[model samples]
Target: MEHPIPSRILVFGGTGYIGKYLVQASVSMAHPTLVYARPSSPLTPPANLKLRDRFRSIGVTIIEGTLEEHEKLVSTMKVVDVVISALPYPKVLDQLKIIDAIVVAGNIKRFVPSDFGCEEDRISALPPFEAVLEKKRKVRRAVEEAGIPFTYISGNCCGAYFVNLLLHPHEKSRDDVVVYGTGEAKAVFNHEEDVAQSTIRAAVDPRARNRLVVCRPLKNAISQLDLLSLWEKKTGRSFEKRFLPDEELVRLSNTLPDPENIPVSILHAIFVRGGTVGFELGKDDIEASEFYPDLKFATVDDILEVFLRPGAPEPYRGNFK
Candidate 1:
């Protein structure tokens, strides 16, 4: 059980929302960090370009290539001790290719596939949510079959983003907060950065080998109504509470005209059915925070502050119907 923390780390989606933080945390922790990025381009947005430059400033080596380059992937893996894939949702299955490369390279001490949401294997969600998790499940099976030592991170919801999605945190002008189901089901909501850091901790910690690290910060677990009340107290305004019961959500999932309205359906699973209800720390799972107690996790109130900031990104206009 005693193993040295990994000194070298490689991140596949390093420029992404969560991966960027992983790269930062790795570098700050004094690990030699590398990030996989596409070849530079004039068409690349300035923000992305700046992020690449920033990673370089903090000594993160950026490897330029695509997943199709199996030889290149193997070559890159040969230099690192850990591989953390933070690939976007649609691209989750592409990690199968990464698994193949890891098997070929054969030196990876820990492989953390991108299951940064709920514990998909344990939770039975609707088709839209299940379909997304099936891709990740494939990657997980591939890694295990390949004899790779792995750690699965089920960090539940990323508080800021999902809270925005669930509660419409950025919609200050809105006179009401929609309450999904009875607004009484509690779920874990770890800050995305905390999720990233805890994942990195698990990747290198020998104790975490072949384990499932659940990020259910006790303080971060609360109901939709708990969040609404917090927001109301923070703003000193009681927004109208509109209730969207479970039956209505299920009906909407079945009847919505646009088959592409899967996002709405996913919301039904998380808010109505309680996507993270299956795993509770001390009752059914191990807590990632127990491994790194010194790390301070942001509270729901802290997350709300960020979303409520002036000129915060516009409220998501997607399928919140």
Candidate 2:
């Protein structure tokens, strides 16, 4: 942590589930954090945000604007040193416009793009994946071209992946975990809280000064089927799941080079083939989950039990930005 403390952060998408946590955490770190909550539109409530008493307690400055909402962005960036973006993964390019606005204003010392799902940098023109990676690459290039100090926080799947889709006890589908092959491909999967901590680490430590900084926790990895199995153990239910045959999955995967409607097709693809990248690293200075600090990870069992289980008590409730 070279810098004593970088102050004044502008967090794009601060009303998101993870964004609210980052906002509260940033405020706790005593950084003057401003949230880019859209000004014209009414913000929708982000379920896991508003409930935190600390969230309410934090003296967070809310800036209502988008990247195109230049006037507002400039005004807010005038005082901030770092900008941590938590916008949707697909919108990484649009977020670049925000980065441009920040640099144009002559302030932002560092920028954290909303790239917390798999190492997009490592992905290639594999069927269905080419286009998404292109967008991510474009945004990264924009930062490099602009000479903006940046950190591409790489994480596997979000807590939502386990808690919402595949292994939750209360899945919309009661099917045995749908998997690719035997589902033994391990990859980095960081919890939202850990990712936020990595963001903070990137924010605080000048040493993490790479054009792309990664903060993965120690042994914070799992496989597609094992993850489901972990959930099965926790929920004590054998899932009625089906495994997509490799040939069929690969054939289906062929349609993904440039998905027709990206978001929709991507969903279809994941459900069809089931996906994995098989990467895990030593705690890369991005590990900070006091909620279960002792445990290396939430495990499919631990996270869903808390975040995904129906009627589980949530921490904050900021609306989606």
Candidate 3:
């Protein structure tokens, strides 16, 4: 049964990497979308200014504030039916404030936290990455304790983003790619747009409430070698593959500086350890593609074709650089 009124969505960190896509998806879904983002200043990047302009032009309500502002968060929570946090890794714990506000407001129907990467509860990653996951786990425990209607999204690897990192599609002169492990470990790589759209759909879904929804389409699953093969076929070029074994990834994860080590550790887990594909989803977990059959998600080939186009922009590097 379809509801007559659309859910009002308030997105925290909506101007960040995946957050922007979430905001776009929310608005595209005809939700009365509101974004709680940092106030813009002359110091803000031109690209970000352009994004803010685009948001305003499209009728998205932008509430400029910080997560620290308790009153503002509570008031905002009062207005929206769904609250989704796309706060990056560093700000994972800050959602506790959002939780506090939700409790005070007592009006939110659902809360989607910033667990958009791996299923933290499942895999055992390198120490650096495991530390990050621990922080997310803390948020999960808090949300469950608060009894907030929530959906934990395990989006796996973002398609174009990881593809750009692995293939260097923007660098025409580059002729080699790094393959983690033997390049035999398969992982899911869902397009960011699909993840965003499915997230929005799941945020309001009755079945998705209080469950973990994984964005793992069978067609999107492929090994590093398979991905390379597809890219080589698309560009009509064969590049040399340099294999980075598990020991080297372990060394980098251990030796690299604080946050610099974090990405390497994550790469170790996903590429070398097969962290994304190691476990089967529990019975309560929802595989997004199967749950929403009508939503057509892009495959790895489709993403490669997008890169082959002239003047295609480089995917957002995020912290993977």
Candidate 4:
């Protein structure tokens, strides 16, 4: 008997927060990974430069080009079986270029767009957050219209990112935590690595093709108050709970400008409106845990434990600014 060769993967925005994990997961699973990133110059941030060097050392082929380069995107897409885009929210519409290139290449087995967040199609959020979801929905429509084989990932809340923001584990001197709404709305918080691993698995999975792969493990589903209590137990410290009601969240969402209101609106959606856990998985949907039983994913408790460590570094906040 012979083993099947791993699919070749091309990752856009491969040096980003979640993108790095996707690239790593692809390489770990023995996929010949390639990264299409902006060409680095002296103006490039040192951290980004180091990430590129690290990827090079790990044998990831780096293709230097922007999304505007249609010829380059087409040529690059021609060589890979899968294209995973981890571009941030601001660049959501930019995926249209990738879609055009995929159509021209006509060989990609799967095209996973940058949707490692909530199930946009199902949830009704505040205007700011809804705008973001609308952009993602637009991309989804484009992909479907182009007849591209694809997978849409709704990985829910990134665990470390949210835990750090909500709990402020790094701020040891801080004595209080913000409890959104009544702190009882259940939401899914998945580790970034787990999100990436499951995404990589689904990119090659026939069952996941053209399906919405949701990363909602049972253990990871907990309320804001539950997360607060867990962190309290882990640190053996009781912090003051500052409750921010839904009305105030909405007010802030309306008052705050641009990106600032974006995160606040998201908080209202997930914590107050129960955006993540609100919907039922339809016939087109598949829960990641059940879909990939063999893949072990870290829970909220596991993520909290990391933050409890003395020198645990903070997770990248990305666009949650």
Candidate 5:
């Protein structure tokens, strides 16, 4: 919890889009870092990847392994002071196995589980998002039961990943900002760098242990209209916003029988519910402005440049849906 972590920091799922950034950030520091991957994950090792690479470069102790192997997880974790898990949401609940192994292996002062989205810690309840929250809760409980020092982190937005997943302009209607229900509901978002920095803070801060940290970029809140305004300003184009009425959206969604297609109504409920204000950044994330005074984050305009503006960026080059 001092100037930096003790050393030998390990990252699970270190080859993901964000995971690569985390490893890049950590390996640049004057401490040892290790990465755990299955050697077959979708993220291929970049060209000329190497342990000597630093922030945005190739640098990390790339250990090929699987989280399913309890013995290997324990063995690798045994040598590290902290663990930053960047695995997918799908593998979150299974992290119980990893936590169990860490507790058994011991000497682990901290663990940063892979929570890189809306602040479940601050959001009083989970609705459509319950399935995602359920996994996070299970992993937290596993860590608590194991008596391991932990930092439960909720970030603004996972930067590129979320934008890529959620925002997709209709191909035919290029000027419309498509959203669920009224676009008035707000949810705060932070860049991947911001999340990574807060994670590093949580990893080393002994005082931050056993805490639920919600973080975001330092700024005033904005609504979907405001977002579209920013897009208009950035792209110099006229755009119309299409709002989906709540009831009709629900009826349309209910027609789909599968849970996979349960409907946008459910997801809309989670977003509009009282608890999830787009402005949410736990006290610490808001306070991070002081520690890293120059920290910069992408804004609505920046997102629009690649997402909406005509000829701003290639169709295939954007990060969002």
Candidate 6:
């Protein structure tokens, strides 16, 4: 049962962190790629303009419009065979409008919504994270009810991004690392590039239609202690370990002062309560690495080696460090 590759692929949020990689993956796979971008606003930053130019130079088709413009979205969608949404957390619920546009367009073969963090259907997160998941779930329900052939990608935590967050790898000056909970609960951390590649692959595969494709590489499935110890070994330096007990995480989640800082609550769910530890390899899960055996995966050790190398670039220094 070979699934035919999509000739024209459309990506929403194609300039985002993961979206940019998806755009490149689609192009590299020789799919005629289209990116849905909003028309440039007066306040649009120069960096964004440069990103658009970069995409254009590589021959990506740009459809400039808003999700509010239903007719425009439908007209644009009508030309593509598959649609992949990489809309970020804040805009996740906006996918329902895109699903509506897909229904109106009536030619979309497969739709991949933005379930790239965790399996939104299963985990019970704290208020902040749960609200984000709930919006995604709403989009899922709408996709199902609209009868859109869909593929839900459960990519777990992205290693390049989340690892920096968890271990503060960019902060070379730091003498201590915060160990969430007992630092014993294991979680999968797929690199962002792998997530994008697997996502684009699933979007075109008939076997992936109406299925949940989870990206859980065995080597990348690690705990905070595993990451901390690995970093220490790589750097040949020992640092103080500060443990954030599960009880403290719960207390902060319940009493955080600012709602925007609610990521504290989400981290509590992931590290303390083991929220993102959804699938075990070869046991009731569709592991992407196993499903596509040819692609090499990045493990936590690999990540630590790169980020801890001499003169390594501080990618997330400003915000994460």
Taken over the whole model, the C-alpha lDDT of each candidate is 0.80, 0.60, 0.89, 0.91, 0.62, 0.81
Q: Candidate 5 residues 1-321, lDDT tens each?
A: 236644678888676655766776676555587888776434655632443244224445767777778898889888889998888766777688788888889889889888765555555432335566667777877788889898877665454443443454324356565655576666555566666766676677676777766654446235555655665675577666667766655665556444443325334543445234534454644344344455555664555455554553222231111
Summing lDDT over every window of 10 consecutive residues in candidate 4, give the lowest-scoring window.
Answer: 312-321
TM-score (C-alpha, index-matched) for candidate 3? 0.97
Best by lDDT: 4
- For all predicted structures, in order, the TM-scores are 0.90, 0.77, 0.97, 0.97, 0.79, 0.91
Candidate 5 lands at a TM-score of 0.79
Deviation in angstroms for 9 in model 3?
0.3
Off by over 4 Å in 6: 1-6, 278-285, 309-321
Which wins on TM-score, candidate 1 or candidate 4? 4
Model 3 misplaced regions, further than 4 Å: 1-4, 319-321
lDDT of 2 at 85: 86
Cα lDDT of model 4 by residue, 233-276, tens digit: 88899999999999999999999998999988999999999888
Please provide the root mean square deviation of candidate 6 (C-alpha atoms, Å): 3.0
Q: Which ten residues in a row have the lowest lDDT in candidate 6?
A: 312-321
Cα lDDT tens digits for candidate 6, 258-293:
555467766777787777675343344467887876
How many pairs of residues collide in each model? 0, 24, 0, 0, 9, 0
Error of 3 at 197 (Å): 0.8
The residue pairs that clash in candidate 4, if any, are none
Per-residue error (Å), model 2, residue 82: 0.6
